[model samples]
Target: MNSELEALNSLIMTEADGLLYEKGLIRKLEKYGDVFISGSYFLQLMTWRDLDIYLASDKMNEETFFELGKEVSLCIKPAKMNYRNEFIGHTEHLPKGYYWGCYADFNTNAWKVDVWAISSKEFEQKQQEIEKLKFQINVVQRMAILKLKNSVYNHPLYRKKFFSVDIYNAVIEDNVNSEEKFKYWLQIKRGLSLN
Candidate 1:
């Protein structure tokens, strides 16, 4: 088996404090760093040897660190600014990326008040939705939207690292048009909200 899968299997069998992070999990987290980081500003961890040399750390496992070459280091928050959303030599920024967003507050005055992260793709899709609302005709109200630019988004199917029931309801009851209640934030910003 691949090293990542083997590590996960071992974790499952050994009653380790954490589960192993797979490549798919890595991809998904990188895809949605904004959502995950917002929930885990301090979730990153590393290991040290008896000589105090820094060994590999599990970004996903809050507890232990697998040594280098044993398993891939768990990318704690893949989409963090320092990694993908980073600057090149302190000058140009990486191309603008998106994070997953949900309606935290429906009012423009409170639009940016709520804080969170989202995947870059979901971030763009939500952008399209808000841009849709920005040009809408009367009868539909556009609430001020705050973009979640860094973490992995979660509800149920999402890794569920940053699940928020309240955000789920806001997206469903607001202006979004998505049939799936899972994409709650997108629905609100899109003006297709069920509410």
Candidate 2:
């Protein structure tokens, strides 16, 4: 990998370990079921502008979930709170009581800290899919995926694509590198562009 990309990844990991975990959010969320840093940040891919932390729960209510978000914000002291409405339209499948919130301004660079409260079953299913993809893709292909993520998939100009999962699936389905797959993926995305 390149030095710049490595530095970005290092910056993110340091924040996750130092700020979130050390501040007791990771431990606090353990009551839910399992806690993880997932999405693009978990994959250690560049172009990830935020830290995505997921709390998988066997049971939780919408109110309780939102309450947890508020507590998290209080603990993290975010500059802004990103509510559920911001993420609702982007999720492909949302489980019962699923909540999305974010903490910003914790990092000096303005990187966001997004928290997702989800169901355990859904989390496991998604992990399986990622595992399957890992089994099929080679190291270079994975790097290609990261390059695509940083260059095109997560680019500010391409607000139509919210996250990297769709792009990852596209890479697998097309069995092609990031650049080639991006061209094909762009042709079929008919969803309303958030830009």
Candidate 3:
């Protein structure tokens, strides 16, 4: 287990010399079966040109979306010790886990032998978090529905999957003051629903 953990730490972390991972973290993983990984969506959202660029990009096809999703899930799953998200359980490419990566871009690595006697406990907790995110996704999904219901932009049909706030912002930028552009967005950060 220690060697596997050591191997994983080597594989995922950046090539920067020195211990990318803390010794204490590995010790905890040996007992906890869970270690958070940073450099997550929040970091990307804050630093990247746009929060939803990858999700909003029109260049990708259905296949690419699934692939990216799979890569992301695999990157995060081991840290959370959620093997279900490793393309092992369902055989479908959906994220069943969320592991908070580190804040620095040190490119810290993971240990393949990351074993915790209580893997099941960690997995259940991670699964609950993923479920919460799914619920949030369903709620925001209404924004896409509104775009279609009101015919707010080109390809109202295509916008069905573009549920991110960044995408809404992009559309608003493209069609300045279209009839469907609700004025309330200016006042509220999250904005309000139109009647």
Query: Which pairs in model 2 have colliding backbones?
Result: none
Candidate 2's residue-wise lDDT over 135-188, tens digit each? 766666666676776676445646444446666766666655656556656556
Better of 1 and 2 by lDDT: 2
In order, candidate lDDTs are 0.26, 0.64, 0.32
What TM-score do all the candidates reach, one by one? 0.19, 0.75, 0.19
Tens digits of per-residue lDDT, candidate 1, 1-195, equal 234433433433332112113323234333323322221111111110000011111232212211211222232222212122112223231123211221121211111111123234545554454344334422221111111111123223332322322233343355432335434554545443333
Judged by TM-score, which candidate is best?
2
Tell me the number of clashing residue pairs for each predicted model: 30, 0, 16
Please report the candidate that would top lDDT against the real structure: 2
The segments of candidate 2 whose C-alpha lies over 4 angstroms from its true place after superposition are 85-96, 153-159, 178-181, 188-195
Model 1 quality (TM-score) = 0.19
True-vs-predicted CA distance for residue 165, candidate 2, Å: 1.9
